[model samples]
Target: MRKRIVRYLLALLGIGAIGAAVFLFMFIRPLPVEVARPAEAVPVQVFGLGTVEAHILSKIGFEVGAALVELNADHGDRVSQGDVLARLHNGEQQARVARAKAGVVNGEAAVKMAQAAVGKARAVLAQKKLTNERKQALLSRQTVSVESAEESQMEVDVAAAELAVAASDVDVAKAALEDARAQYQLETVLLDHHVLKAPYNAIVVERHKELGSVLAPGEALFTLVAPETVWALAYVDEARAGDIRVGQPAEVRLRSLPRQMFEGHVTRIAIESDRVSEERRVYIACDHCPDRFHLGEQAEVFIRTAALDKALLVPETAVEGFDGTKGVVWTVEDGDLRRREVTFGNRTLDSRLEITGDLPDGAQVVTTLHPGLREGRAAKVTEEAAP
Candidate 1:
């Protein structure tokens, strides 16, 4: 009786399994899927992570090392080019400059004296020549002794030599004057270096040294930025940077002001890329950024690369084997399921990929991925969105 009961139970279980299989094959054969066709007039954008930066930033200081005697500007101060920002101790440099001025004055006096000497020698030489000529005429007429004429000639020769020496002295004096003037100029330049001046129209961002602090050459006393040169720098993934071009519209959101968006445009694209991170550096010039700015502040950037008239977009999560340019995706063709490889183009900021390749006419691309999808299986659109 137990064996008979066991056989009956086994037969019942077998019938139930057969019924389940039949129901699954007949009713569940066609998979319902949500699909999206090509969309029109979609804006394409690429996302990047970056920071607020400036095109012109500077660390300004004195060229010569000295004690900082005065500070005329501090952080947040606005300065114009050639405005005195600070001053080093000018005592020693000033003394040197004064000494050079005295030397220049002395050199001028020497030059004048040498010129006077030259003129005197020339006058003496003229007189000697006159006397020598008169003696020569007297000797030719036998009115003077030959020895007297010879003596006159010797005197004239001596005067001529004196004139040459005086002329040489004049040259030496002029050269000395030039040297003195050059020395004075050099001293003046060094003295000027003791005073730090603004390089351009800038806003002082930082002050590194206090007054009376001694600093080394090229040591920064203040940080400066050209207010007009403020911009945003973005580091975009190289894979998505192929479509970025100069003058494209972009939007920037500073991390400090997360809720606000700043309008900007692409100003420059670096020819080189970050080697380790494989990112391209792009510069965006802000159109109406605030007067106050913080350098190196974190920011988000969205760059509009293209505007699509009609495009089939699939989320990056839906594509299989996506290599940035091409990927495989599911599609519904003739009410049947299929997997097709398609080429991709510009990516939107929300991480959607644009389909650029030829998809079959009247075929709907599966956007909502579902499990158990098989090729040649009957498919139906669960929900369709209006174009």
Candidate 2:
């Protein structure tokens, strides 16, 4: 009785397996797929990942070293051109400037004294010339001795030498005045350096030093971002970058503002692509950027390269072997799958490829391929449910 029971159970399991096989074969015999249609006025877009950057982002510092004394601007502060941002210990610098001014005043007085000396020397030289002429006349008339006339000539020579010395002294004094003035200008410039000022309208992003902190030349005191120079730096795939051009319209979506969309335009395109990533760098300027922006923020950009009035549309999943501009797709004809070569046009944001070639309207395309599905294999067309 036990042997009979085991044989009965084995026979029932065999019958169930056969029925399951038949059910599966009937339901999954042919590949079922959806159809595609030609579309019109589809906007072609190229996608890229990018960063929010400032065209004039800078790490500003002093050219000369000093100790921090006062900070007029802090992080997030908006400053205008020539606005004081911070100050270094300027007491010493001020003292040097005052000393230079005093030197200039002293130099001016010296110049005046030299001018008076020159005038005195000229008057004395004229007097000596008159005396020498009178003595020579007296000698010719036999009224003066020869030795007296010779002595008069020597006195004239001595007077001329004194005049020359006085003129040289005037020139030397003038030069000293110029030197003092130059020193004054230099000292004033050095004093100005002690005060850190903004070069343009910008927003401060960082503050590195505090009061009494000693800073070195070229050490960054603050980081600034020019509000007018904010832009997006995007890296586009080399394959799709062929159509990208400057002045084209684009859309930007920043990571910080996820739900908001911004308008922009392409400003520049890098000719050289990244060798490792095979991406071209592109710069886009915002049309109406945010009042405030964070540097190096991640972004997504879509550049409108072209617009097509009419194009044959196919789901991106239905196409394979795409090399940016060209790809292949599987089309159905008379209940059999056939390989069709297609040239791709502008891709839509909805993952639809614009077919450029002459493809039939309302043709069935295979979106999901199975291992059993091959070229010339019979397929059943099924309509895709509308989203």
Candidate 1, superposed: residue stretches over 4 Å from native: 2-28, 385-387
C-alpha lDDT of candidate 2 relative to the true structure: 0.85
lDDT of 2 by residue, 1-387 (tens): 999999999999999888888766754467776666556677888898989988898999987799998889888999999999888888888999999999999999999998898899889889988999999999999999999999999988988998898889989999999999999999999988888999889899999888889999889999998888899999998877888999999999999899988999999898788999999999999997876688899999999998888766777777889887777788887888887777877777688787777555555666655565677766788885231
Considering summed lDDT, which 10 consecutive residues are worst modelled in model 2? Answer: 358-367
The lDDT of each candidate is: 0.90, 0.85
lDDT of 1 by residue, 179-291 (tens): 99999999999999998889999999999999889999999999999989999999999988998999999999998888998999999999999999999999999987965
Q: What is the TM-score of each candidate against the true structure?
A: 0.94, 0.81
lDDT of 1 at 319: 89
Task: Give the distance in Å from residue 105's predicted Cα in candidate 2 to where it truly belongs.
Answer: 1.9
- Superpose all Cα atoms of candidate 1 onto the true structure and report the RMSD in Å to 1 decimal: 2.2
